[model samples]
Target: MKLHAADILVIFWLGFLTVSTVKGSVASQIAPRSSCVDLSTQQLDIRNLAKYEMQHIPVKAVMFITRRGIKICVQPDLKWVQNAIKFLDKRPVTRRPTTKPKSKPKPKPKGN
Candidate 1:
């Protein structure tokens, strides 16, 4: 079988293109999902303020754009709200009372 120089060049270019495309897709998949989240410095600052001041503040919802560029907002979990509330309502925990009265047990009856 005779392999033409042009055929080899074409095969090399095609392989290179295919490899690059696959690498690009795999790299994108491995990248952190939050890297695309549009959390601005101002927004993050505002969120921090609300988190500190309010027991349950609704901050920006997380969103993702699909390959077709459709935006989808993910609902925050109920536990996240609870956590926020707990955080805001947290008070300094005090130490428990150290001294407790010891209970005395009755002596067992003598065996017959």
Candidate 2:
């Protein structure tokens, strides 16, 4: 089999195109959906908040996830929001015990 410069270039171009197409699709799938249409200004209890995620589409806002599984969209520039984030960051993390406790064995009954 004879090798040519044009043939090598064609193979390289095809490989690049395949990689680019796959990368674009994967990126779209990995990006989170934009769910915030309205931003809330109401004050939220820091104790109820579990975590937060920053959203860019539709509007730039902070999505706060409460411990009760509620999602609240708030303006990122709000003073309370910023303070809440700082408080959450400094709060201690509580984790559930992973292992089960050992069970006590029952005493054997006396033989008749």
Task: Compare the candidates by lDDT and give the number of the best one.
Answer: 2
lDDT of 1 by residue, 26-108 (tens): 88885434322333222221124223321122344544343355443333344554454465457355577899888899899
Model 2 lDDT per residue over 1-112, tens place: 9979999999999999999999989888866564787999899999899988888888999999999889999999999999998998888888998998889899999999
> How close is each model in CA RMSD to the real structure?
15.0, 6.7
In the predicted model 2, the residue pairs found to clash are none
Q: What are the clashing pairs of model 1?
A: none
Q: Which stretches of candidate 2 lie over 4 Å from their true place?
A: 1-34, 100-112
Q: What is the lDDT of residue 46 in candidate 1?
A: 17
What TM-score should be assigned to candidate 1? 0.32
Instruction: TM-score each candidate.
Output: 0.32, 0.58
Clash count list over all predictions: 0, 0
